[model samples]
Target: MGHVMQVYLGDKAQLEGVIGSKDEALLSRLLDAAATEDAVDPKIFRAIIDGGPFDEDDADEYTAAMYSICSILGGQSIDSVVFHFRSCPDIADIFYDWAFEDLLPPPEGSGCAIWTKENNAEELAERTADTGTDVNDGGEGDEVDDEIHWMNESLLAGKDLIFFWGV
Candidate 1:
């Protein structure tokens, strides 16, 4: 078998298979925090957003909804979704914007990026590697290289790329 890159390209139904349903208790707590005008505790927020239930059909749409809900409950502007979520390092892992820097912009809160041969996926991967932020780097450079190679092969074969993170 060959190395595989962690990318997702599908509607909400497919994402549901990836992340699954939200826990009722977590939702209730988030709602309560909003009702009381209290900041959402980071731990609770992570639990809900990271692996929490997702009943929606479009991952992009659902994630945006989540950001809105979390932001409102936290009394922060929706525009601060990235900053607010990034404060939690684990949540930061959910955004793959770096991978799509010059490619098609991933929808905000959708957590998806597109890549194509025309956009130079190979060059982008190389640039990412050179910058030491290839998204596959969890202290494993060789593995990341292999993933880049896999992406190159896929793109060369005329397969475009759509990646999802943060779920």
Candidate 2:
């Protein structure tokens, strides 16, 4: 089996806030962790998330997607966001459209995809209604369902959902 997908919820504003802070050590560690695929130290991870927008408490470092979710979401090309992560406000919409309406197939290549609070919450609420499908049924309590539930929660909470894979 392939490695499970990992998802992180971040606040772009909070991350941007720390990008230029005076703590060079924090910035250095953040950069290093972001650039490497190895397991990050828990203390360093905590400090990094503390200064940045990453919600360590809710991060799903091991999702059930098994990396296949990347292909479903987009493709392996979006495997990294080391330094160029952007806020993709329409990602959830895109996923819903494809997963439900059968449109917008995954893009040609991948790097990283994100969905931020820039989208309308009311609209998301409308689109997020239970589809009663196995792909996203939250009743299973499985990692994939849990991950999806968390993604929805993050979006609803006005946070950003970042998907990084292929590492």
Each prediction's total of clashing residue pairs, residues at least 3 apart in sequence or on different chains, is 6, 4
- Model 1: per-residue lDDT, tens digit, 68-87? 34333331111122234534
Give the per-residue Cα lDDT of candidate 2 at 106.
31
Candidate 2 local lDDT, 7-62, one digit each (tens): 55555444334322455665455446445644443444343334434333422321
Q: Estimate each model's TM-score.
A: 0.29, 0.37
Best by lDDT: 1
TM-score of 1: 0.29
Which residue pairs overlap in candidate 2's backbone?
77-110, 77-111, 78-110, 78-111
RMSD of 1: 14.2
Cα lDDT of candidate 1 equals 0.42
